[model samples]
Target: MLDRVITISREFGSGGRELGMKLSEKLEIPFYDKELISLTAQETNMSVTEFLNYYESIPVTEQSLEPPLYTSFSPLYEIPISDQVFLAQSRVIKSLAEKGPCIIVGRCADRVLEDSINLFIYAGIEHRIERIISLNKDLDPQLVENKIRETDRKRKDYYQYYTGCEWGKAQNYHLCLDSGLAGVEGCYQAVLSYLGHCI
Candidate 1:
């Protein structure tokens, strides 16, 4: 068994989620994706709807340039629901990491775990749109293209808002792969080969 957690950050419509699942199955380890939302909801006593509403989003508060200082906050004070949801998810992330090695995708997971294998997956816009359309046959291709760009923007903003780091930067990840180039299984094998060297 591997001794480290793997966190995957990817652009919308990238096959990163599928890649993460493949790795989890190959490694015989647990995987966290949408499952995180339910766990976080239970942890915070928030409804799943509420969790999904605030999941991986930046609240529109112009309070400060930095992430809220969890250290100085008073128990008596109330924080925004978005911030509260983020904090809850963070706690759930830490708790899961402490339990055992696993694969965590999205939700700025790369920055949450102290010791983890951080991976960033991206693809060309055309490739992304194609992938989405293939999976979602009822959706319009043009709308899929637009959603890809908009969702990526939101992801970038959320990552920057919480971590103060640029999302999808090569330097931030241990390994970066272009899913559009090699496809999902190819990327999975690449990750396996990379992991063979490290763990």
Candidate 2:
């Protein structure tokens, strides 16, 4: 079922966003990544920077802070900024999905929109380190690896927190590709092949 939507959930430095744009072009569909942040900002009258920081993250509760016993009763203001941003982004994602087919990267679009083709891109740690260095020269390899793991952990926690599904689990996605093994060109071809079979 080509639902006219593709959601890419990926580990940091996995080239997932790049693959999303590439697929978007080949499929002649709109691609949304950072554009989602800007759109959410406009819809919520919030700053793009705010969404950038909190969109996919679960807010940290202070020491001794208690979890809400009755979340439905709490006013929106009582909600954490992270939750607010997620709600705004979810609204934007669903609205966009309704308009037409598109490729949405990150921001938990896979979980937010039902029946969309979900793909998760990931690579080995060493491969990710090299990829990260290729894009950003002059970074220390050790630090780059650290950051990559950190970001992936954050994403995993955030996804699980919101969706109760483990991140990067094969069962949670329609397709899981190791971009490190299959270069972008190869991954792109695989996606086309998958879609061809689906149709």
Query: Which 10 consecutive positions of candidate 1 have the poorest summed lDDT?
Result: 68-77
Which regions of candidate 2 deviate over 4 angstroms? 1-3, 50-53, 62-74
Top-TM-score structure, candidate number: 1
| Error of model 2, residue 39, in angstroms | 1.2
Query: If scored against the real structure, what TM-score would every candidate get?
Result: 0.94, 0.89
Give the total clashing residue pairs for model 2: 0
lDDT of 2 by residue, 1-199 (tens): 3557999999899899899999988888899998887888887677777656766678797731333321233466777777777777787889899999999999888988887999999999999999989988999999998999899999988787777778988999998999899877788889989998875
- Candidate 1 structure, TM-score to reference: 0.94
Model 1, 1-199: lDDT tens digits are 5899999999898888899899999999999998998898998786787667877777786664457643324452366667777777888888899999999999887887778999999999999988888887899989898888899999898898888889988999999999998998889999999999995
Off by over 4 Å in 1: 70-72
Q: What is the lDDT of candidate 2?
A: 0.83
